[model samples]
Target: MFDQSRGFRDDAVETCPVEYVVRKDGKPFAFLNATPALATRTVTGFALATPEADWTFERI
Candidate 1:
């Protein structure tokens, strides 16, 4: 998935990297960092609205 919300920037602001992993039970799991980013600076006291449950996908 490609997100272009912040446009193309070298600082990678508002970017969230996602990785897929397999759990011990062999179930696919997605790990993502929802932390907000600032250009060449540290973000403090910032909160993003994230889903409370894990994301699920179904094949058509």
Candidate 2:
């Protein structure tokens, strides 16, 4: 699901634990944590977007 055209980049750390880090065009984007949290924004640009649905939790 990693699309090069979208200019998405991902990384992870070992010593300090974190799920993963995501970036776009070499800038800070998102941090996918180990636990789920409320979705504060609506998904638009990604495929299978559920704009109509009241998405409450994030799990990736």
9: Cα error in model 2, Å: 30
Question: For model 1, how does the per-residue alpha-carbon lDDT over 1-60 read when each residue is reduced to its tens digit?
Answer: 444885565554346443323222234443333433331121111111223433332221
How well does candidate 2 match the true structure in TM-score terms? 0.26
lDDT of each: 0.33, 0.36
lDDT of 2 by residue, 1-60 (tens): 345876553432222233444434344456655422212322222213534433232334
Model 2 misplaced stretches (Cα beyond 4 Å)? 1-18, 34-60
Scored by TM-score, the top model is: 2
Predicted candidate 1: what Cα RMSD to the true structure?
A: 12.2
TM per candidate comes to: 0.19, 0.26
RMSD of each candidate relative to the true structure: 12.2, 14.0
Count of clashing residue pairs in every prediction: 0, 0
